[model samples]
Structures are given as C-alpha cells and as structure tokens.
Target: MTPLFSFLVLSLKFLSADCKTEAGFCSCSCQKKELIMKAVSILTVLSAAVFGFFVGISFPVQITPQLQCGILPCSSGDAANYSFSGTSMIGILWSAFRNTNIQSNGTSENHAVTKPKGAEKLPPGLVVTESDLHMRRLWGSPKEDVATGKYLLALAVGYSEKANVNATVHKFSDEFDVVLFHYDGRTTEWDDLEWSKQAVHVSARKQTKWWFAKRFLHPSIVAPYEYIFLWDEDLGVDNFTAEEYVKVAMKHGLEISQPGLDSTRGKKTYEVTVRRNDAGEMHKTNEGGRCPDVHQRPCSGFVEVMAPVFSREAWTCVWHMIQNDLVHGWGLDFNFWRCVDNPEEQIGIVDAQYVSHHGVPTLISQGNGEQEGSSEKVRARQWAEMHTFRERISNAEKERGNSAAALEEYHP
Candidate 1:
C-alpha cells in the first residue's frame, strides 16, 4: 500500500479505539458510534485498496531491452540492457504529455504545429508519373524502380514525322522525360523506335498542341520538372543538344527561352528568332521598324510558339493564359512577357544551340488535304483567334483600370 493510504488507515483504527475506550466522553452514544465506525471502516478499506492499486502500477515496470532502447538512446553492449528507474520513466511520460498538449493547443513552435512564413505561396507536394514501360517487381518500392527525369520534352507529333521526332528525341539525353502528344492516333507504330518504349504517349486524333497541353500538362502535373519543352515535331535539332541548350539558358538567366531558328532555313516569320552567327551564345534581337520599341516583343522578349522552353514558374502563368477554344496559340507569343519580370532580359533565343524550323504543313493537313485550301482555312482561323485574344486582354486591362479608379475615388 502507499504511505498516504497506510497512514489514513492507521488514523481510522486509532479513532475507532479512542471511541470505544472513551464511550461516555465521546459526543455520540455508543450505539451510534458503533454504526458510524462500521461505515468509516468499510470506506477506509475500499479507498486504501483503490490507492494501493494505483501505487502498485506506478512502480518501475520491467521493460524489455528493445522497448527501453526505443524510449532512451542506448550505447553499445551492456548499456542497451539497462532498465529505466521509476523517476526517469515518470519524467519521460510527463514530458511526452506536455509536448502533446502544446501541439494540441496549437502553441508549439515545431514545424508540425506551425507553418513557416510565406509557406502559403509554396507549391503543393505533387509528382508526375508515366505508364511503366516494363513490369514492376513485387518486392521493391515502386519509387525505387522508377526513374524520374528532371526535364520534360513534350511534342505534338504525327506518324509522318517519325524520323524527325526520333532525331529530336536523340538530341535530348535520358535526363529529359519524353511525352509525345499523338495527333494522328498512331501510338503503336512508334514502338519501332527504341526510345519510344520509355516515352509517354497521349493519343488524341486531330487535336492541336495547345489543346493537348491545356488538357494534360496542368501546372501541378508538371510541377516536378525544372523546365518544360513544348515544341512542334517539325523542328530540326541538328545543331541542338538539350543539355547544352539548358546550360546556355541557365547561364543567361532565361526563364522563357527557345532555340534560335536558322536564318536561311524554315519560315522566318519573326526576325527576333533568326540565329545570328556573330551573336555570342544567346541574344535579344531588335526588329527596328516592326516593333513599337526596342523593349517590346518581335524586337525583344520574343520567341515563336513553334518551339519554346519554359521554366517551371513561367509555365504556370503561361498555361493559365492559354484559351480553351483558341488552340492555335497565335497571339499568345506576343503576351509572353506578362509571365516574367523584365522580359527583355529573361526571354530570348539560344543562338549557340539552335534548331531548324521545318515549315512542314503536317498539322495543317491533318483533318483535310493540303490541296483543298486547308492552309487558307487555318490561316483565317488564326487571324480570328488572334483578334479575339487581343480584345479579351484589352477589355481585361480596361476593367482593371476602372476598378482601381473607383477604389481611389471612394477612398479620397
């Protein structure tokens, strides 16, 4: 029994003896004193039993060596066999309870209880996965067996451009994750190429690259990649190496960049994209009369949508700017500056690692034959989409300006 309970029991016995010996001197009669003593004796015994039970359990428990080691750090050899004292065990339990209480109250300084400042702006924990090319082992962790690539190379491809696509995939090392958006629904045929087995194939017949990107490449889905290469399959990568291009882009701090187009080859729609033999590794070209100013697009901060590389941060904003209906991405290139700060410096072309844009009318002739005025029809749609995009941006700017004016007026 506990010392406290034993003392209480002894005091009760003494009181009962005193009552019997000085029955006349006592405040109550002997009969009443006997009844009261009987009740007090029963209660005292019951209370003492309960107190003793708690005291017994509170004594130092013989924990196994494994459990003791888990509770406290164990040194090698005999130290691991040592048992915890009652005092030490109690202290450990009290400490654990106190920590749990602090966490439950949400007042703990621990990371689990309180988030760091600016954590709200951080991206969520997300990773992209592709279909396994081979059967997985039953024993090992799935993550251990999977090889995650750092960069992404996404292409909109047709079966006709298989040779060019194969050449393009070869330009990139295994560090890049290849994802082919098949517009012709001929995914099985690509299996002939060795790299095709590892690549992720997303088949959607007669859909534009923009449409595929919008539907599949959500910001969260591709968040793990350092950079995303969204390109058309018609591009020639004879002069380009993905690793070298990344190095040049990183050296120049280009967030939104592209490989420079060969001057003589490909449709030179924009003068800024044309590769300069005299220009060092990369350059921000200036189209004097075409652009309103040297700081603007087509003069600076410009790359065609045919082949563009985006940093993870920049692509998040660009992905949102892509319209659902306007899959052509005609006018989107002009507004690419909105995604980055000081676009004149961050957006440019890598001249050292350039690509030849083959103006193959592969995509234009998908649903319809090239001889049946498909080119004209596509061009007309592009013009209409560009007009709609410009109007939307203009309207958005006007609304924002009006809201700011009203807020200022109200405060003043």
Candidate 2:
C-alpha cells in the first residue's frame, strides 16, 4: 500500500482499536486522517529537497578558470587520520575537497586535497560551463601537514639530448602524474612544451641559459609535485625505485630527501634532523654514517649532481628561497640546505634506491674567457644567496612551530 494509505489505516486502527503507545501519553488529539496527511506532507517535502540537491549538481563541473586548491574532509569510518598509502592518497571519498585552502575554516572529519593557491580573475570568461569544472575527486581540504592529496612528479631536462623526445620517463613502482619540460625547445612559445614520456622531437634551448640553473626552469613546477627529481641528461638506476622512496619520505619528512646517493667511486650522506623520541622507530646514529650508528649509507654533498628529488611542499618553500633572488652558479643542488636543523624545512637524506647520472661531464674549453669568469662571479654570488635563504628558512620554521627539543638538533 502507499505510505499515505498505510499510515492512514494504522492511525485509524490505533484510534479505534485497543492499541496505544504509552497509554495516556500516546493519546492522539488530532484526527486519524489529519495525522496521516501531515506525515505524508513531511515525507514529500523532504524527498523533493533531496532530489533537487542531486539534480543541481548532475551536470559536469568546470574548473573556475581561477586556480583553486582542492581537498577532502574526513568522515566516520575513515582511518580518523590521513596517511600516504604508497600510491594514491586514500580517504578522499568525493570531489568537494578541491575548495579547501589555507584561509578556509571548515569543519569536516575526512577529505582529500589539492595544492594551495590560485584564483580566476576573468571578467569576460566568468560564465560557467562543464569544461572548467575541475574537481580533484577528494571530498574536502585536510588540516596542515595531514596527508591530503597527490603530488605530481616533474622533471626538467636539457632540450638538446631531450630535443628529439629522447628522454625516458621513469616509472614509479607506484603510479603518479609526471610532467616534463623540454625548456625553450626551438620554435615553441613560452618556448617550451609540457609533455610526458612521448616520443617526439623537442625544440632547441633558448640562448639565454642562466649560468646557475642554466636554462628557464620556473618556480611553478614546485607547486605540482610532492617531490620533483631535478635531473640532467644522464640518470640511470639499476634498482632505485620511486615507490620505495615515498615510503621512506613518510617515515622522515625532509625538505630535500636525497636517498643515499651513490656515485662513480664514492658516496656522501647527509642526515635529516628530526625530534624523534627514544621510543620512536627512527634509529639514532652518531655523527658519521656508520652503523650501530643507525643513520644511513654514505653521502657526498654533491655525490652525483644528476638527479635529486625535492618534495612539492619542500620545493615550494625552496622556490621562494632562490626564485629571482639568485642569478646563477650556487647550483640548485648545493643551494638546497637542510631545514632539519633549522626552524623551517629540515631536509633529510634517506636510504631506499639510488639514481645514477649517466652523462659524463665533458669540458668544452671553448667559451670566451671573460664570459666564463663573469659566469663564475655570478655563481659565487649565488652561493652567498643560498646561505641567506637557508637562514631565512630556519628562522621561519622556528617562528611557526618550534619545540623546545628542536634546538637539540641544531649544531650551530
């Protein structure tokens, strides 16, 4: 029977028959027909509202032209806390998570996340449509330092060797979106094309290679990747895997997590400082990378200068450090200082897998001498700037959330 009819019949029977819920308190003042109509009215109203809510969002969504970070909120049955699940960040149950940002004060238990920053300022294109309804598929934004979204992996390589689409896109044992920039390849505007590992000819590099970073590598790349591997033409690894590295990174949040870098004839290692309690899983080791020491394998400050992974968050912090401030020569590798020791980003070194720089360094010995010396001067200036950035990061970290024990890791 229809719900209205069923309710009407039951009400009439209760009124006439010996049925009562709580005796005197269960007495119905309203007529049976009146009670039945009210219940039906409420149900109909509720059903319509719910149906409307769904229909409102039925069409494909569009990205709001303006860049907005997405994130998800947590819910019951969720792990109660977010974490990296080796590949995709789980816990994001839907798409609303994309609206979260630092400024948003929302109360939700579970959600996924997009990176921070971006806005649309188009007055003419403000009209809405399906194409731009960009959603990260996660529910909402997460709290700070909480695992909320996927960090894209990116690579910046020289266009010459990579000019003909010759560069190989390394696969993470886990899946991730990898964006490649064949910077300023010939005839391309902005002059470079954003591509993945597709076999196609890239353009030639623009002549204005900054002596320091060499070519035009934007700071924007820092926003997309959780960790970016800045690599040159020759990077090879017999056994190093990206999936293993992510596991290690979660164990130790470092600004620059350079896995035990193994080079041609030697190894150099740097330890990331963290305030781990004695009971924590991170083993304590002495100064050098010796065991019983429990620290890590060998490391050279610049063991290979070939491929180094800089986490997206870490890279963004690093981007502010050197972008536009330093000209050239401090070298992106050497410029990255350990935030592990400072107040800001304490970078750590991990031991998982290693990548080898396959290209051999060859001296051309033909550039103009004055020009070379000028480049050297520029590089030296960069070194000084790098140190300045390091100090600033340390200062910032301390201001945000420095603990009393944080100073224990600071040698200077």
Candidate 3:
C-alpha cells in the first residue's frame, strides 16, 4: 500500500477506536480529519522549501572540464589523495576524481565523485576555479616532497685555463644541482656536454661570481635549497665527496662552513683553517687570544670567502648584505658571522673533506690588467669598500645599542 493511504487508514482506526500509547497516553477523535489534512499540506510545502534552500547555498564544484572523464557527482572516497602523473593538470585532477569501477578505454573512470569529507567550503569574496589550482601546481606552488634532498652547487666559471671548471662539475654533479654561472659569455661550448646541458646556466661577460649571485641566486631563487655551495672554479676536490662533507657539517651543526683548506698549496695566515684529519669532523681549534666572548673565533664563526657553504637561513641574511657594486666580495667574509646565531658552534671547518686551493688569484690579475685597475689601485678600492662596510655595520650596532665584535688576535 502507498504510504499516504496506510497513514490515513491508521489515523482513521485510531480516531474510531480507543487507543493507549506505551506511556499510557489515551486519545479518541473522528472530527479532526480535516485538521489532519491541512497539517500534512503545510508539512509538504515546508519540506520542499528546505530542500531548495540547501541546493541554492551549495558551492558549485567542477570536477571534470572535458567529457572524456565521467560526469557523476562526487561521493565520499579516498581517491582524491591518490598520486598520478600527467603533463596537464586536468589529467592529474582526473586521476584524483577517478575511483569508480566503470571503465573507459581500459582505464577505470572516476566520473562519479562525491563531495570529499572535511573539504573546506568556499568563503565569501574568494573565487577559486579548477584552472587556478592547476596553474599553481604547474608553477612552484605544488605540494612539496619533504623527504627530497635540498642542496645546490653554484660554480663560477670564466673559461680560464687554470680554473678547471669542467672537472669540478663532473666531480660533484651527482651530489648537488651543479649550476654554471658562465662569466665568459660563450654559451655554445657547454652545449656539447650532457652534464652541462642538464645544469642551470646564467651568463654574463667579465663579471665576478658575486655579481651573478646577487642577481640570480637571491634568497628567493634558492629558497627551496637547504645549503648553497658558492664555490670558485679553481678548487681541487680530489680528496672530498660532496655527500660526506654535508653529512659531517650537518652532524656538527655548522651553518656557515667550508672544507678545511690544504695550507701547503699557499701561504696560510690563519692556522685554524688549516686541515686537521686527526680529530673529529670539526676540531675545537681557534686563533689563540681572539674573540674575548669565547665565541666568534676563526675556523669557528668564520669561513674563507672562497668555496664557502651557507645554510639556507645563513644565506638569506648574507644575500641582503651583498653590495651590488662590490663584485670581488673582498670585505664580506669578516662580517659573515653576524648573519648566523651562536657562530662558534654553528660555524666550523670540515676537516674530513678538505679541498686544495689552486691559488690562481684570477680576479686580482684580471682587474690589474685593466687601464684603471692596477694591483695597487684595486687594493685601495677594496680597502675603501671594506671601510665603508665596517662604518655601516658600526652605525647599525650603535643604533641598536649593542656592541659589535672587532677582529682580535694574539701571538703565542
């Protein structure tokens, strides 16, 4: 029997006969049939209005743009979290939307999707479409793989005979993103090599590495990477592996660190930076009588400008300090400890993987050859720049009511 008829019959039977509910409430009525009919009519209209209101308030969700996929409205499922690969965002969306057993051309179709549970409802004044989400994924805003390695190697090359850029690229290519900042302006020669083709190249003529770095390797550009190896081309890494160096540095918690320099290659002034393989990954050595605060000493809070490796946090601060006009980076190393916190423990040399300085002195030689750039002239300009940097730092410290540490040393 129809629900309405059965209800009507039951109502009539209850009206005609004496009835008692389980709780002992008694009622008898026959004149209320007209009243009951009016009540049902009111209920029917109210139900329709409520249903229409719900549908009106719902956010319009577009799962599939192309008819190639299924068109069924979404249901609750775990399919939205599934991983899939495709060139187009639509294909990726299709993968997440698809979970139905129904097949189209041997592929299971997900045309019928339900509203995902816990999905955020659209708020007022905000409009997000399928295309917007797709564009975000296509660009840099996609989901990040937290487990993936985050390191990069930035090499500065001038095609100079003594630099050996190609050999360095081959040595650490697998451990990091080997990027070539070509200062020679010739892009054609690197096109022949497979590694060169894979690497990111930034070209400029006769400019130093710091110039390219100031423009391209900004904190924003290298934000995704955890560590950046801002290295010169002349270093010999035959005794080191990039992976081992990083491991040791990480273990020791060094933020601004570098491989210990082999002092035999050149005249070494600071004894702390000299390699010592006899101890742990990092030795507790320092230039005696320096850093009265017991921290910020050489080989602890300081690393040489050449082949310096900076952690992401340290690099962000260092990038802001780099002057656009000062390309040589002559006076920057002395102030590097200011960028990091607890530099004594957070910065140190990794003696486990040391590199030999080829001692080419390419930048000084190149500048000296220029008409306005004799070695004496370059030295004077460098000193002026360093003096300016010191003045700025001093002013900043004075404004903050904090004293900045000055370079100190004592002979044994």
Candidate 4:
C-alpha cells in the first residue's frame, strides 16, 4: 500500500474505535469532544433566547380597548358602542399608567383621578363651580334674571307683626331671595305670605344677626350669590329697588357698601351716610368736618351694620374677621376699609336707591320670655353687649395692629 492508502485506513480504524466504548452504547472522545459539544449547546441556547426577547418587544400584546366619559373612563357597556382610536387609546393608556403608578406608591387613585364630588369635570383654569351649592331657582327675581344683580337678602327677624315683614316681602320680593333668621320661638305668619314660599327660614331663639351670620352665612352657603345683605327686619325699602341698588353698586365698584340711610327715619346716622337725592352713586362728602381728609379712602365708605351689604369678596374677609363672642358687629364699620385696597374707590353709599332704617329694634322687642320685664331690659342688655363688642374690637385692633397694617398694604 502507498502512504495515502495507509493514512485512510488509519482514520477509519480510529473512527470505528471511537464509536465503540466500554459501556457499548455510543461514546466518543471522552474529554475533548464532550467539552466542545457542551460549549456549542450553550451558544445555541443563548442565541435563541435573544431572538425571542426581540420578537416579544416588537409585537407587544394589546389590552382590552376602552372609551372615556369626560375626564374618566366610560363603563363597559358604554365603551362597546365606540371603536378605539389611536389618540384616545394613547390617552386612556396614559391615564391607566398614571393610576398604576399612584397605586404602586400605596396611595388611593380616586383623589388624583376622579372628579370633585357633585362638580362637573371642568378643564384646568375654568372656574365654573363655587362651593358646590345646589342653587335654588326663583322666578321673576332680579337675582335670577339680571346678570349683575345676583344677590341674596338675609333678614334677622323675630316674633313681631308679620305684616311689617310682609310689606317688605311684597315690595322687594321680586328682586331678592329673602331669608329670615327667626330669633323668637313663637311662630309668625312669615310662611303664610304669597312670596314666603320663595324665602328661607332658619330658627334659633334670641340669637343676634351677627350670631346667625357667623353660624349660617358661611362662604360655602352663600357662594352662589354675588352679594349678602344681613339686614334688620325694620328696614323701610320704599325707595330702594334691588335692581337699581345692584346696578349702582356694581357701577361704582363698592365691595363693602349699603343703601344710604334715610335721614328722616334712621337713627345713629352719620352725616356723610345720610341720603341725598341729587348726589350720584359714589359719595365722599366731608360734611360737618367729620371726614377732614375727604380725599382719603374709607372716610366715605363707612356704613352702619344695621343695613350693610357685603360683596362676595368683601364678605370673605369680613367673615374671617367676625368674632364669635362679639355677636353685635359694633366696631366693624370702622374696620370695613381693611377689606378693600382702595376703599374710597370701592366703597360707597347708594344714594339714588336708598332705604329707611325704621330704627325699631324689632328683635330685642320680642324679649327673651325668661330674662326680661320689658323692652327696657332688652335695650340695656343690647347696650351692654354692644359696648363689650366695641371694647373687644379695640383690644383686637391693638393686639393685631402690625398684622393689620400689613394687610392694609396688600394690593388686592
């Protein structure tokens, strides 16, 4: 045999020997071949795993489609009607992802995702809702019909002749939503009048007007109304029309204001606050040298508590300032200007449409059944309460002088 034939014969013999093993079932290259084959198997597995991962990323699973209602998702039944669009799907996915993230942090998703209670889900920066009060509708009233004349008139009334309050109800009932705070336990005919159906009656025996206001006329309760009139029951509204008064007050930009006091019928009336038929909406006349600096603000803005009206903005500040113990708002008039930046420009007496302060302490007249002999004792108690209120206001002003000065400097 030649060298090539010898080599071929040797290779065949080696392969046949390798195929045979002591165990007699397929064994080859006991160390070197085993190692090489194991490496190849690992490489093949790694390559397959990488390829599978890429395929999964490229063709992701689609979740069940959903539709939206306002800022929230629609129910399953409602979602069925509409096919999922790419844009809407993206929004829904984004919202779900946010909710998921919130839940992951151990916080409830409702506060962040759901709309406010009883409030329409409005877009950001649009203030369509205030305090979530379900506004009561009254027909033929300026408060309902006129855009700028949205106001609520709150009267502090007690057991007296219903005829007195009824007269007021008849005259201005078409212009205001009259709310009566009954201080007398004895029932009256207030609910019997024709317009009484439209009014709100709150009963609490022997509480002052300020007391009722602090407890009841909260910002949330009166949030729907533009102005709040905390009036006494004895006001004579013969010349006052709510429409004209609101028009004039809005035109003049009075934040804390009132109808000018009728000079004839009103008592404890300030010279500047007294009504003048000829004067226009705004007045700062320095009569009898009371307001020496006529040009200065708040000199003319002063109004008595008996018939004062507070704009929504002004009422907010006034509400905070009211003291629960000081039920009678005696010193409030002096500090009314604190609520406004430029009181001279924003506060005024509505001279054209004025009311007569009947000067009757009707509430106190209905003496607390146990405490009094007559109206004289009630008058004395009122005097004492008012005096204490004034003193308390003085002390408060002194204590909070620095803070008040800072507030006065605040620009709106």
Best by lDDT: 1
- Give the per-residue lDDT digits (tens) of candidate 3, residues 125-188: 2432211000112345346512323688888876673237776766673546667787777677
Q: Once model 1 is optimally superposed onto the true structure by TM-score, how far is the C-alpha of residue 101 displaced, in angstroms? A: 3.7
* Segments in model 2 whose C-alpha atoms lie over 4 Å from true places: 1-149, 159-168, 183-224, 264-286, 289-306, 329-346, 357-359, 362-412
Cα RMSD of all models vs. native, in order, equals 13.5, 16.4, 13.2, 13.9
Sorted on TM-score, best first, the list reads 1, 4, 3, 2
Better of 1 and 2 by lDDT: 1
Residue-level lDDT of model 1, residues 1-412, one tens digit each, is 4875675666557556544356555644555566567667867888898786556545534342544354585532224225332223443455564453323212221222123335533332322232322324578787887667788999999999999999999999988888999999999999889989888899998889999999888887788788999999998888999999999989999999999988677767777888887789999866454655676566788887999999999999999999999988878888888889988899998999998888998887775664678778877888899888887777776866653321100010
- Give the per-residue lDDT of model 2 (tens digit) for 250-327: 666555655454455233233322111331322223244333323222122221234546665655555555545544
Candidate 3 versus the native: TM-score?
0.60
After TM-score superposition, the amount by which residue 186's alpha carbon in candidate 4 deviates from its true location, in angstroms, is: 3.7
Q: TM-score per candidate, in order?
A: 0.66, 0.41, 0.60, 0.60
Backbone clash tally (model 4): 0
RMSD of 1: 13.5
- The lDDT of model 1 is 0.76
The better-scoring model by TM-score among 1 and 2 is 1
**Model 2 TM:** 0.41
Model with the higher lDDT, candidate 1 or 3 = 1
Off by over 4 Å in 1: 1-102, 105-139, 287-292, 368-374, 402-412
Better of 2 and 3 by lDDT: 3
